[model samples]
Target chain A: MLSEFDLIKRYFTRERAGRASTVLGVGDDCALLAPTPGMQLAVSTDMLVEDRHFFAGADPRKLGHKCLAVNLSDLAAMGARPLAFTLALALPQADADWLAGFSEGLFALADEYGCELIGGDTTRGPLNICITVFGEIEPGHALRRDAARDGDDIWISGTLGDARLALAGYRNEAWLDAASHEQAGARMHTPTPRVALGRLLAEQKLARAALDISDGLIGDLSHILAASRVGATLDVDALPAGLALQREDQALRRRFTLAGGDDYELCFTAAPAQRAAIEDAGRASATPVTRVGRIEAAPGLRLVDAHGVPLALSLRGWDHFQQ
Target chain B: MLSEFDLIKRYFTRERAGRASTVLGVGDDCALLAPTPGMQLAVSTDMLVEDRHFFAGADPRKLGHKCLAVNLSDLAAMGARPLAFTLALALPQADADWLAGFSEGLFALADEYGCELIGGDTTRGPLNICITVFGEIEPGHALRRDAARDGDDIWISGTLGDARLALAGYRNEAWLDAASHEQAGARMHTPTPRVALGRLLAEQKLARAALDISDGLIGDLSHILAASRVGATLDVDALPAGLALQREDQALRRRFTLAGGDDYELCFTAAPAQRAAIEDAGRASATPVTRVGRIEAAPGLRLVDAHGVPLALSLRGWDHFQQ
Candidate 1:
């Protein structure tokens, strides 16, 4: 096999040097790029490990897509437009087929979002993928979680709980008879970052607080609440549980809906006066926006049933340090 | 043990939100930061894996410092001022003592540079560290390897060969006379990023082309040649071979000088007219800047003896994908 240097030269460095933005690229101590005038770069990183983040036999294409998508999700949360990303992939050995599939999936999503694969490092080790994505936003205009206030309406994009149900049993191959199941599987493998929606919100000045739902809806939404110094009462009935959750038992359904992660949906807040315009914007964009809760004067998260009664839960959601 | 969520809250988030250029930090889907006004952000990433990059039993403090330092070295290459960084750490399990030691070492260097730990992700896996550092530089003024002109003077900071020799088993742990070996070991473990010198060079507008020496002087210098579409001839007699190479055989010394990878010193090119000012700046800053060679009109790298004869090498330096 060719050594690492030769491999990078052959495969990764095959692209031509582009414009002035990249002053220097691959084969240096670091890649140097000139940021555009009046733009602030948004930076985020995520790490995925074999057997811990995904199964050993998981498809490389899915893995690659998810890695970039997760990082993009972070950019979206910050109201940043995707620009370029660097991948740091650690593997046991070079597997050509795996690399082909992985690159195809990664580039496909990157192309769709107009993100460039500017630089990366590939090394030999147990499989671990760390991706750091860079996006650009106008200076001082990125969305922040600390700006929300009491009496703001909490909104979520698309349905929840389906990703959790799929993770429980459906391995992206199995599907239930629902249009959203295909999307849920796709979300599990290759989440579509809410980039456009984020841009729309930023341009319209609608969202007071925003975050992408990577952890379960409640857990992730709680982050905004804590940061905003407010509380929320999520109306469980208003949640769009997708299709998979509809087939589960009551306890399982509630568990999946409340604590399942990997959704990649956007949970944001806006003032009540702006809700109509925000809903109209979502409709015009063909993106689903559901009002699931409201920010409250209190300072801790609470859940209310359709009848306005509290429900109990044994666990919150997936925690990374927990086994 | 606390679950991963609690662990992150306790250890990672407990620190006061760092203030370098952060607009919003932690607690959100992504941390948001704005580059300093009139400055562009310089970004770089690096990954370290168990056994491949460092021994499994290596000190956590040293390992953590090395990981962040390497990325900072990239920022140094671009003549950027260190501002913030994100760390992605994958581990088989949580070890409180290891985490504490690692954070101590990392925070020490970060505090010294005024670089803030802004955001990151941690997960379960074999020990792997990926750190992405961000810095600020004047727009369009960042140093790059592609700008070296044909007649530029080549310069390197500090001595070479020690890191390679230390890795090659030329060390005495107990002997007080072996201070150079101890220094080499320290260099291998906790390299100090040349951030201040980089900033100085940028502010003074001295360097024509610049990069950090991570993959040996020869290999890395070759990159400058390749990128700038020029060649170079090094005077072996004038090369700074460090104390570790002083007692070695000529062939072994040559090998050490040619292929040592962990030096983390700055290698740069400057116009002949700027040499006096460059030396003056280096002296003013107490940074040893030595003239090693000159960029040539030809398009291939060549190492010459005192008599200007080419030397052969079995291998250049460490390649990430090479075994």
Candidate 2:
């Protein structure tokens, strides 16, 4: 029988990029990291479990990428640059091929984002992956939820609804051929964390409030409203959807855009005067930015039609622990 | 149904004691930390799963304490003062009483060590808890495994075999009266991490190599020897067993002391010249330290009995994914 030590040495242990932030990594009881001087270290952890987070036969490569990508999205929400991450994994068994593909996907994205894997633990149990990521941001420059003002323009980066649309296709609620299914499924399985845009927001002092839309736009926007003590009026017709989703039934597309979740795009607020600067930022990061709404003094979220009448909402986003 | 957000607000969220190192605590995408000048951040993660790490019906209070204790023990091995920790938890159901008890145990230990609960994730799944801890240590002062040298005296802190005895009693393989059972069971359930001794080792530059004895002395010592490219000579008679265990059969006592685990004590190597200072550290920390053997230049472990005759062994310590 191959031992756990051999499994780690063969699968988890690899040559690091010699990141200056990582002083010591792996092997020891604890890995050592040196946070950049005068910068605060931002840390967050997210866990994914089999069946709950994904189907049993989901691709190991995509699963691994999604696990780390979601955590990186959290760092993006806080406008922090990627530093390092630790992964704690539980597996039913050590499948060498599965581990190889998983590591390939994990390291690919990590290398692209300049985030190094520093330390982690692997054990025998039902499949579970928990990643804790570290990033850095200057003091008091973080794009906080409580910082949004009454007149700030609410903005979103990249298109929405694709991941949810893909999920709908997977469950057979929508029709799609092989290529279309693959496109949408890819969105659901592999999310590109908006790291560059987030850094731009922090460095250029663009956003007053920001977060990635993981839960549906409505539920997540409520967080900012509650934190900032403000309300919002979203232009329903202006909501951006993936090209495939936009061509679907308008009502279904609207539901996917408004209430469907799993999108890892940054939604943020900035003063109305910074619209041109927002465009420059979007261009600089090569990500699309859409004006979705405006922060208001009212206390409740209102979805306005073209004539400005509010629409009623009955659908809810996914919530953990809601059985 | 209680939402994950509501659960975090109701249970996990709390006011933090203002530590200069913690710039931001919970209630955000990520927590922010500030490492002290010129100090490296030491990080480690450990995961515990139901039925694998502990019995299914184990008390949640002690389980919580053990969860954090095990991770803190990793920091103790590195001689780091714990700064903060993140708890990623999965629960089958939200039992309020269980959560209350678990939080109580977690907070009590965190408060004692000044290690704050910073941030983490909560989700519905099979029972699991993963804790990632961060602490600080100065450069070039960390007690590393590769630093052990020939002639270094091998030292053990606190008593061993009690936890193993508790396990034997639980399995009905050994006879322990009620009082004795509880005594040994407490050792298994609430092993006190030797944090002070590790810090003393780093500060005083006494230990050449160090690690906690979670996987039995023989197995964990091999980790040091392999990393250092050295070997060890153990004086089997000098190995310490708890008073209760010592009263058992001599062979049973030796096996438990040698092969049994879950002893969160320090197994470290130090120069024989530091004997006086080692004693002073022990008195100052009020923790017993015992000289068990010496590091050898040869490439394998040798265990000698009272008359210096070598004993042979074939058993190995627990490995999570042996298959």
Top TM-score model: 2
Query: For candidate 2, lDDT tens digit of each residue in B72-184?
Result: 99999899989999999998888888888899898899889999999988988888899999999998878877889999999999888999999899899999988778888
- Candidate 1 residue-wise lDDT, B33-117, digit = tens: 6677666667788889988788888898888788889989998888998888888889778888888888878888888888888
Residue-level lDDT for B240 in candidate 1: 77
Total clashing residue pairs per candidate? 5, 0
Q: Which residue ranges in model 2 land beyond 4 Å of their true spot? A: none
Candidate 1 local lDDT, A135-158, one digit each (tens): 878766677878779999999887
For model 2, residues A1-323, the per-residue Cα lDDT tens digits are 56888877887788877889998888888988888888989999998988888888788899889999999999998999999999999988888888888888898899899998888998888889999999999988788777889999999998888888888887889997777677777778999999999999988898999988888888888889999999999988788887668768889878988887889888899999899998999999998999999999999888987678888966676787874
So what's the TM-score on candidate 2? 0.98
